[model samples]
Target: MKQLPLVYHKKILVLGLAKSGTAAAEILHELGAFVTVNDSKPFEQNENAQYLLSKGMTVICGSHPENLLDEGFSLIVKNPGIPYKNPVIAEAIKRGIPVWTEVELAYRISDAPMIGITGSNGKTTTTTLIFEMLEVGRKQPLIAGNIGTAASAVASKATEENTIVTELSSFQLMGTVELKPKVAVLMNLYEAHLDYHTDFKEYTDAKFNVTKKQDASDWFIYNGEQKNVTDYASKSKARKVPFYVSGKMKEGISADDLYVYWNGEKLFERSIIALRGKHNLENVLAATAAALIFDCSIENIKEVLSTFHGVKHRTQFVREWKNRKFYNDSKATNALATKSALEGFSEQVILIAGGVDRGHSFDELIPHLQNVKALIHYGETTKRLQEFGEKQSIPSVVSVNTLKEAIEEAVKISKEGDIVLLSPACASWDQYESFEIRGDEFIEQVLDLNE
Candidate 1:
């Protein structure tokens, strides 16, 4: 179905009432929709709610937006924080009212071609790298979606020739049906966000939705080694392209001698990839695959390989003391991700692991304990991880409360060649505003040894 430009007179239900919620309500209300905002947080303390109310939006605090399903709205603009099976969403679907994320709503109005990147491990790194590749031309791309800014903010000003590189989260994927990407890449998927999703299968279904709506006209790139992505593409009709870091793909991108391939074609070969870790290699492969699909010059991808600095949080090299490195991958907020983070090291490593438990199993990361010199446990996630470590007879030290204490314990136990790795296999919400905040704090504590 061709998407219509949203008309304003329709009644709209904007749910979640967070950062995205406020942006959605303001845009809709200005466009003439009778907007009602709903959030779990009390409207009195929410700054956005107070501001939106002052601007004449009908704010409904601490209530479900599902109550308004009978009001006959044209569409529901859902916040990505709300799960797809979220009670309000199911009710809206039952009522036959179209539901969209700010992304879907933005896509309908955007005249530009969007390039979307998704996966459990490397969305931000790939999205940021894509943006850097585009800067090869004089064109400055709109880097939005699940990254820098909401899609609505970009859509408000997009033109046909403008290019957008969007990072898509699974929650954002759930609300979008036909939001096709010119090039969509899924790096790899692991069990993440099970708490929000109720189960692993449901969470994966949402992540896969990023490519579910694609046709022959859209390009889909996925990890060749990821059995889940490669295996599922055989069962689906979407146009499939595989990328690999260890083994080479027959027709798509692969790494051999620090070079990348395209469909039966060698596009760019480089020895200048400076990012540490195999996961980052996979990330670069995804970025290069999409760039090649877009007909980005081999020279451009080559240039980006060296010039494109990595993102702030993930596996960032914070400091080196006595030639021993300190790596902060605070974004490793799930068991699978932390496992990937640890595998980057071959030598004895002191790992600061654990955070708020998110209903994922600790057994998944147990294999990585072999490389761990010592485990400096922190946050509420420690008890479970310690239990698993003890059962395996892996060496560990227990410390809770703050990252400072965790790092201090790790440093005390570190040998000259041992790496200090802060790769928590859990969320940072228990201690910091975000993974970014947590990473920055880890860097601060690491740098303080010079004091």
Candidate 2:
């Protein structure tokens, strides 16, 4: 890890002690910073805060204290989930104290070259693909950021020979200042997380932070088909490399029915790609561009792309049984995600959907329901989604109390040449703790059918 002289002996506040915050606080303290860790959880109940206290750092718990900033901190390393509207963050901003997330700290200490990936969607899939490709190429790659692992933890262990493939969120990007990657990817941006950012422009601006500090020597791989992404790429100082799904781009990665191309040169056959959906095609194009720029061989890229089914819970292909295919898309926690998943299939889809009721209408999904042969609705949104499916005149519409029952119904109705998909159009919180758990249930039960 690089020595960060800027943090040495400086008084820094590490706010909201989750995994990111704990890692940041420990790293800062190790770097000779006077680190004060804070969290809303009470001292007795907060294990992270307790652990930090054991390490000889000052720990604040239970509340923000209202006067916490009055102690005079040099900087605040905030948790990405914490909004700027928080009193402590707002005060720090007003005082010009420079608030940042742990990703900034990761950038400062890492010896490895980073490849940052960000977008409204596809970040995880793209990040995983790049990491796998680099691995196949024998390039040492470490995955981190929003894809489960903490960036600061990964960055600390990364060597000069390693490449850190990070999945960045707009929240994490918002706190970054000088965190420029060697190859930065900005996939298609859409309207999302307005509640956290407060507006569309701010959300867009936050996503652009991935390429904000890049120089001419760096590479910016973006979506050429997205006008917003292309317009933002124009502002980047990095060498722009855009990927197009429609196969119309003059340069960079574009594809036709036959092959995937890089700068109009054939790299691999399109049929080799195992992952479904045009959305995934965009991800593949962007990931390929980044991997190629990092010097990965075409052979290695093709090897990974051909075999990689998908990231789990996000349109992951489970298995084929009785000539029926199954996909676990439990991460489709909204209508848009389900729509994208539905579009990937040409075969009759026995779609199992419904989850936590956010009270939003599923009317937006009307146009995409044409291919759905059966709709097994479950969870809190069952009635709403059942109504939607019945209104759409889907051949078979069934409502169930649980996901297990829904899967059973799908199995009964599914026939040869059918695709049974679990693309719930709402969040999983109503029945499961997270989408991962919900997805795991689906995979286990679906696999049981083969037995």
- Each prediction's RMSD to truth: 3.4, 1.2
- For model 2, state the Cα shift of residue 352 in Å: 0.4
Q: Give a tens-digit lDDT track for model 2, residues 258-364.
A: 78988888888899999999899999999999889989998898899889999999999999999999999999998889888988899999999988999977777
Residues 1-451 of candidate 1: C-alpha lDDT, one tens digit per residue: 1234465587898987666777778878877788888888887678888898999988888677545676677778988888767787888788788887888867776778888888888899999888888778534577888885988778767787678889999888878877877777888877777778878777677777777778888888888887888865665456777887775567777887656667646666546776766788888988877776666777787788876546877877788887678988898888777877777778888888877887778777777778776777778777787777778777765656688998878777777888898888889887777888899999888888863
Error of 1 at 61 (Å): 3.3
Model 1 misplacement above 4 A:
1-8, 30-32, 54-56, 65-67, 84-87, 198-201, 235-239, 264-270, 307-309, 357-361, 369-371, 381-402, 412-417, 429-434
lDDT of 1: 0.78
lDDT (CA) per prediction: 0.78, 0.93
Compared to the true structure, candidate 1 yields what TM-score? 0.86
lDDT score for residue 420 of model 1: 91
For model 1 the local lDDT of residue 220 reads: 87
All candidates: TM-score: 0.86, 0.98
